[model samples]
Target chain A: MTDTSDLRSPTPDPYLSMDLLRFTTAGSVDDGKSTLIGRLLYDSKSIFEDQLEAMETSSKARGDENVNLALLTDGLKAEREQGITIDVAYRYFATPRRKFIIADTPGHIQYTRNMVTGASTANLAILLIDARKGVIEQTCRHAFIADLLRIQHIVVCVNKMDLVDWSEEVYQNIVKSFREFSSRLQNIVEVTFIPASALIGDNIVDKSTNMPWYQGPTLLYHLESVYVGADENHVEARFPVQWVIRPHSDEWHDFRGFAGRVAGGVFKPGDEVQVMPSGFTSKIKAIYSMDEKLEEAFAPMSCTMTLEDEIDISRGDMIVKPNSPPEPSQDIEAMICWFSSGKTLSGRGKFLLRHTSKEVKAMVREVKYKVNINTLHKIEDDLEFKLNDIGRITLRTSAPINADAYKKNRITGSFILIDEHTNETVAAGMIL
Target chain B: MNYTITHLKQLESEAIYILRETAAQFEKPVMLFSGGKDSIVMAHLAKKAFWPAKVPFPLMHVDTGHNFPETMEYRDAFIKEMGAKLVIGSVQDAIDAGKIKEESGARASRNGLQTYVLLETLEEGGYDAAMGGGRRDEEKARAKERFFSHRNEFGEWDPKNQRPELWNVFNGRKHFGEHFRVFPLSNWTEMDVWQYIMAEEIPLPSLYFSHERDCIIRDGVIMAVTDCLELLPEDVPEKMTVRFRTIGDATCTGANLSTAATLEDIIAEVAAARQTERGTRADDKRSETAMEDRKKAGYF
Candidate 1:
């Protein structure tokens, strides 16, 4: 292909700055998830001396002959004793070509909400499959959730090749089965397969000597070279106001800038914009980034915008292009990932809805359907959604919310439901 | 003007956004300022979050009373410069009041006792949110924490029941008597903090840089010869060129032999170092699950 070796070289170039990638790992409890992460971190030299020492000592105390690299991520006492991840732990490391953020999520059925959390912002999802247990129920559940979350890229890491004796036939069989199943997904953009042994560090960060029949790039190579430039929302302009900056100083007494992060698309200084809720229209006069001003700002950059006209803008209000403004709706239909143990979400349940910078009271109007993750079937009769349950629900808000479909703009389309009495987050919802 | 955002700038924006959200969502939010590089950078970000508004909250320091004199001085000056209110919850006070008994022996430190004082202060202040400079890359236990970590009425964090933080949406909802610990720099690493401080020209305590200090060599670590550390017949004090990788109670925080004098020097040193910064914290070296144990007991 495209000289994968050259891409993995540690050459500092400015153009390679756009290659930043965020991915998540999901699999069953025994699918070698932690081993895969440990292999990636260790082979990439991301593990520190202290961390290695700690891992060695812990391994010795646990009566293991070799260093248990999985202990690297099993931080909690309960997690170590039970050998399961109870929460989503985020890890950060960088190769010369790109920076990476890995959301190590739990794979148990009870912790499915954590997976939803991890997959929400990820550009790619790496679903691990044990070679011995190819395409099990948990695999289907993880794949379906990946599809539901609209993850653009998926790298199926068939781990434990050592157990399968590095058989090419077994690898091809698993790949074929996964492909046939994934084809039924609604919007699966891409799915690539790689046979690896995470415990022995094969095909994770370097070329595997065992898998001679396979010719695909290593996991780290794929991560560094994957084209993620298109992951950002470049089609719609959305700016959710966080705070109003009024320097109120003698030098700039009249300077009023609306401070917020650019959530989607690009905004130039001369672009005509509309302020939500107030329905005020104006042109962007300036885009301030700490010390300097810019002509344009894009997704994920936090900056202050000074409009040509002084609009009644405040925190929780959204700024958008005048001609292509998102519709404000009080009634929203979304897929909800329940996260609270105190209450099961049902019809006419009052709670708080927190969208980007905005919190408004909302009520669940209807529970349309719940997906049985194992069977990949919709259970329309089941209306009650407890903790870690995912279902389609309609909600009515106290005030009209400016929004977009989650598939279109991840930054604007996501929301969390908060319990009124306990003030705990009860659910996570993604707009359809 | 042309405003180009480097990766560090993007991270700063994300941190500032989270800080603002905490301030807006919680009734009384306080920033935990430890006068270290991370907390100092966090204080600066807080200032930027509410320009001309005086940070919109007070800064609380759970003082172990065994802090470096330079760090205390730096904390006062920085707080004064920002025109923000400062509140100190002393572990010494807690010990004197018999609220928390000090640990005895060679490993005795006020590090664990600070948790009790911190929780008491949160209860007394009725603070619904407390912002910390904790970064996920610092330790494995920290890696599992949410940006908005919820604590019970007793200030206990149930790591198993954390809210799902998706996208940039942080859930800061908490009940009465309950508080949220907000970590704005969860994604930042030690190297990133140094680089940001260097680029932003953020001032730090002089203890972070190399200087000649009287220290005792114990278990291959330079222990600062402070009043809290009682010299043993076998332990001899020696003057050495040292700098702190992390700032904590003087009794437990160890110093490393280094000649990194400036921010740039520190950046270079960190880039070349193979050991993690927490390796220097004697508190974390107690056990494999030291951090997790402390976190479960409400140690921030």
Candidate 2:
């Protein structure tokens, strides 16, 4: 058994025993995004001295009045030199309550694929809108992508309030426009608007003295306190076995366990379950998280489960409850965000599809329609999905894959398309 | 009791997920162990990942031939403890075989030379995936590195043309000669690693804890006095209570004077410390794009 005796202290340290919150940042290219992220990190006291010193030097070299907070997040050489956010740069910070992983995604129209990739795993998203510009096309597009990705929380930070003299009229105007457009967005459960200045550091980490009009939680406070525990699908049980652990040792000779992360729902020690493909009926014998026997294992918990029956199972096999099992089918209808650069996804293209822990040969069966991201209108007759294009498509797999609708359970329903030729992740698909 | 996992437990689960993925996806995989805390944590996770079953993949140490004696001792004990097979890719062997030239004088280091040997080892071992204990929080350039970093046949990393790794799914597709340098610890920060070590009671080398050791100051950084580094006339060796933040080639690895004797002490030290963990490393201070330049040329 793996030793975990030292982990149990006399008293639980809240700071060390806290959870994590992963959030994504989306905004217009020049919406002071880097500055806002920089502000959050700096005010949160996560920025190290060396990084801050480097940012200061870069800001001096760039001849900016204030240290360019954006410089901290713009890690790549090309991105720094070009003064643009190209790729998604992940930033880390922690408070007494929670640890945050900020996915600083690019906001350009061409980088919609990057935005989608960032939001794919995020629980929350921060949509930055320039106070002067109000709710523009970029704001709507970010909100649409956030909604499409089913991000639970959206924080609308109406930034650059310093330029507008912290006027409530401009802030309310932007908030009103955002709410008007955002009301149409689906799946975004909570929407929050805060007026702040990224440059002068208002309403980010500390309470803003400038904004007596704003009375909501600070961006950092909300991030730490946001309820993400209920974001997963707790109704249907799903566990895709990623590995099988068999000791083959004398001490524990007959230890055959199916190891995987719980994709959805709760699994206890005596739950009646059925293995996919084989349809072998079994009852859960024991659930273990590295020697610690658990009463139950829920979504996202990596655990090993031993069954009452010795059924043959592999990496791609899934273990689900007898009730409301995910539909198994060879044909899959999905919305794919094409990511292949310089390579257009044509109809009838063959690719390797990976779902949960399943990987099978799949071919693009049909290209149904392309939806214009800017207008959110479905375009028919246009079947081609080029680089950074999101379109509806149908696929046929070589073998049957068990999966749920992407909206119902993001873990089991979502998959990535791999180009066997180039071996690159060509697209991210969400089962419809 | 809260069944929900904490950040440290969550990180452990995520690391295990990546390890299992590497084991399942690749034909031949190896864990890059260096006797460092990060690699030690990686090895421990590998144990939990395939509990009851011995670690499926072997451990490969890209020996710089400039290691602290304690590192080798810890490595041998760990290998024995885990019953893991050890494959050493020696820089000294390459130097002796004339496969690569050795650097001389103050700037000479086997630290950069390990890259070539690492690539050679991968090709020779027929390894399609080499798991490293690298974390993105260590360096700026590493922040953009994907969990499954693809390298061409020539062992080159194309930063601009990297794949987008989404969700828990990792695409480990490769050609005949190409392989992947997967990082199971990509998202973990320094505090998280120490916190995890404290939580799991993972054993590390004594060198990590503060001890009285002979050291010499170079570039305002205290480096342990070892055979790997030839001291200059002005360099004076001093006995001080120093511990290493990162374990690598002793020649370039700087030591910080501290009394962090226990895991709890280390965690407190890490939390209160202002500079980045890599701030003590002299190898990365070579240039602004030192890590980037080396990464492009296939450095883990």
Candidate 3:
């Protein structure tokens, strides 16, 4: 029998542990979001026999002459028939270097909310443009959404190079136009351009034999090589306590650890920390994982922390560095991505606002402006924010909230608005 | 001191953060524990999420009473070890009291019956939030699931009207009688889960590893011939060296041929496996969209 106690501290092999990469894919109906994902899975050897068999069966049933690469990601039957992505479909694959989560989002205007939801947490967004089309309105819309969501890295894959006879001028022109447009968006930090065909497997996973003009790394190579370490907030120490861990067992009876994942910065055992809302100060006693205690914990680590002094702390409460604390405010000015279809979000509508671990009643006080995604301009006259629309809004909450700017901290700076009557999520907002 | 977080660790942190959000936001919350690896991992994360302090909520298992014996044993011991409360809503009890009529046929399964017991358990416990180990990578319909999934009074999931989950902010707000099903492991894949389990060194039931068991071949699936499973003359019982890909009712949950004797070996096996774990599940084989249909009916 495997001893239960011995199972707690088994040594881990780091080489076998896979790294995760969260990315978003954007493409018009014909630009091949599904084909690119299918190609990635196919070439990376992530596609399974059953999935391929299912694809083959579905393709045959649909009376298609060839395997529909789009069928792999166009999950909904409606989407498969319509030849468009109606909603965001998340797909997972892994390479030796990194495990990937692709949020394949629709490129149309109606599904912009889905794009926003997909891009919000993504570190990188793969914006696909058909080489023949150059830069279209849909391309601009997707890029604008990626920028609005504060996605740092943008890989502009100029797809279907095979269709365009692998023209370098077309690729360069598209790249220049995307750069010019992206320069206007404040959130986009880095943009890389690659010319490839998702259908023929050119520069997707392997070097394209046809495209001798292209010298950049393959799409898979770029995805695996991109430095995502700077993606997280390492400037501020934010630990939102998920739960208070107090094992009543005899061995750990007196342990009072604050269980949470570190959202930003680095937290050491001896670092002085302040509990949010209550404003109580304490020093970290220990940072414990499942098997052992650690001297320090950094951003994106879920570990239990014990304070030197017994401070009253609970879930929704934050532990941060004393010197650089997040501003606690009841009035929040934010950019809201309206998602509900019931009614347009207007001023002074009561809703539930969830920030980090805390939820409180909030009312939208004012609509500052609505963003015209295609034009990249703000329309102030339109006070009504409808579904799939991005707008600026002011909110007043029932209680004070500890928050940072969405740019500074993705974890503490974001919130969602829930409809009180219907209890549906109405909007997603980022604190400005 | 420098702390480096692996990709799986980052995902775990995100999940723990969501779990904390559920506990903090909801008035009363409980975790859905099915004795599956995902649920086991979720429970482990929950324990780590609120370490030093007790997990703020109890664990609810909607027991169909047709589970693998090892699963029940593991569940009981694991709950006891974690010092977390475990609440079981028996489908057998529901059938005995006539709350739900037991299906009597070749296709009869208590799988659909567990949803009623689960919903009733949540209602009785006043649990406004129920944490589940659901992941988007599991099926096609689950691809669009929100981190905080809302359910109506009848516990039906309206896939058409899902809440938009942006960033790490989860909306767990619900009215009385309604509840939210929160999936912290939404971003995690099958390999990620196995790797995390291996990295964290979490204990699992022996059935997950290669074991000799008397199982019957029915409908191209190896169903464990337990007391809970009714066998017909057509079903041929045989002893095989097989391991369960997923643990559910002994009748529907299928086993895979494997030589994996250790956790590391199992992880390697899963990493190299060509098909998804759900490919072995007979319940999902009922239709092309069987999982979707069940999800719509509030079957977690």
Candidate 4:
């Protein structure tokens, strides 16, 4: 009994007080994105001894100038052999301030799908730029995708400062150029700039003494302190029914609860809500978060809600505040990013569209225009939406889907197009 | 007012969402239970995902026949307590049927052979989705794993051709004769699992706690002295107070010298420990790409 005391009145757990930050990194192999991530993990003491030992052994065998940090992320055999990252890899690290999940995405033009996939879940994006080359085509392309994904925060890391002798002029030039370019983008809300050398370990986790002239929060500091709570839409109440809980057992015979994660706003018992697609009104009876009754629930919290009335609701139906109900329509206009290389996006192409918990058959009605990712210009001439091409298209669904504009709500506005025949995710769309 | 929740709560919500998605998407699904802390947490989350109702899927265990007796006892009691169905895939039966051959020598382990039995069990049971406790933070290859990992008709994973998983919307669509290995714990680390276990008061096997046991030191690893392991020339048996960081095949799972009798002590030990949790996993030490290779061939 005395030994079990630790499990009972345990002092405050360090993890319970910490928050979480999910950010994605965008850059080419030459931009030292891997090294920057490695330095952050290494300096923060997240890299364990066994992993470091394995990395050292692999580095020696490969005959590299510094234990190639790229080996830390390139997990697959093909990626290691070819010295490139073919897919998005997730890495975790934690500080006293917050726990961080890094979506390490490759920078090649062909792998734009990976970046888009990584950025889709991230609250922030880290754009890496080489000091020698201030701002290039690759930089603009990465920034455009991040903005298109509606990533609220962007941290421009000006790396490889050791090669330029920690020049403040080069960092400022890159920052100015990036600011000028990002001003034209639509959805990015905040941007931060930092000067550092990933290989030499400057300004990543610790404050660098080398750059006495530069003054700002370190990369890790900024990440730990950034305000991403406002990123979630807390004004519009929306809950998409994912699954219905029905217990046939005698103990819970009459149990019928609608389960889902809150996509936007706050919900509480006694709130009036309207069921979508079949306009029905009901009052929230109770909210349960894993058997524990909650006073209130908000975005990103998975819970079960019981309505006052027995409404015919299933997985595809949504419950929202009656005043702010989304417009239910069969026609949807969206910005599409084609992901499948085997199949190209063409007009009148039919695919399965998954938005929220609803699966509907949709047909591409028209390809309005394609955007050249490099120049961030509307390329109306080339309507051919090939792999990794961003374009605007009109889609008509087999059924009416109640959706909000992407700018208002990320969860309700975004959708994915699945190839009907191959079952591959062909494109990601943001409702315009 | 602060609108943010703690990291633990956030991770719990995310995992619960994935578990609910699995229950809704697949006709037949199962949870792979190993009686380890990770699996214990996963099962606990599953119970919460559909409360007032029993877990929709059965809990499957691929018995290597080289497990600690304590593990078998704990697994049976856990299943009975959860009021869930249990399914076991026996590796020994596969070996007897000539489906897989047993390895020879002192370092022989049935870890790789369990994959054959697992795949066969899934085929026979007609389960289209198998939810595992595999975490991305555990190994290098797993770092690239998706929440809904697709496997072909041959039950092989194509890492390069994995579908893009974006946001909380998990694409679980698969063709007939194909299945997906869903990992609701993909974002969790070993520390996160332990912390959640402590917070949730999830019951685990007694093997995780410190106790006196017969052990042998091999290549700087404290291998438990079990009947299934063949003694090498350098292997010497001794009584030591040791605990396992991970629970796997008894012949391959290594123990660490510790006195962490409670969850609190274990958490403190893990925080100060210098090595990864899988560092003591003798199976992963077989080769550089051991886990990756095993996963490609359909290992959970």
Better of 2 and 3 by DockQ: 2
lDDT of 1 by residue, A352-404 (tens): 99999988999988889988988878988878898888889999999999979
Clashing pairs in 1: A293-B1
| DockQ of every candidate | 0.42, 0.63, 0.52, 0.62
Let me know the TM-score candidate 2 reaches against the reference structure: 0.97
TM-score of 3: 0.92
TM-score, per-candidate, Cα-based:
0.93, 0.97, 0.92, 0.98
Select the stronger candidate by lDDT from 1 and 4.
4
If you assessed candidate 3 against the hidden native complex, which CAPRI class would it receive?
A: medium
Q: What is the lDDT of residue A302 in candidate 2?
A: 88
**Local lDDT at B142 for model 2:** 90
Task: For candidate 1, state the interface root-mean-square deviation in angstroms to 1 decimal.
Answer: 5.5
Q: Write the per-residue lDDT of candidate 1 for residues B1-300, one digit (tens) a residue.
A: 222345566678888888878877788999999988889999999887666445888999999999899999999999999999999898888889889999998768788898899999988988889999999999988999888899888899888777778888877766667888999999888877886786666888999999998999877678999988978889989899999999988998899999999866786688678899888888988887788889989999
Best by TM-score: 4
Candidate 1: residue A179 lDDT (0-100): 88
Off by over 4 Å in 2: A1-12, A61-65, B1-3
**What is candidate 4's lDDT per residue for A1-432, written digit by digit as tens?**
012324466565666577899999977789999889998898887889998888888888888867788888998889888999999999999887798999999998889999999999999999999999889999999999999999999999999999998988888888999999999999999999999888888888888899999889889889999999999999888999999999998988888999999998889999999999899999999999767888889988999999999999999899999978898889999998998889887789999999999999999999999988999778988788888999899999999998889888999999999988899999999999
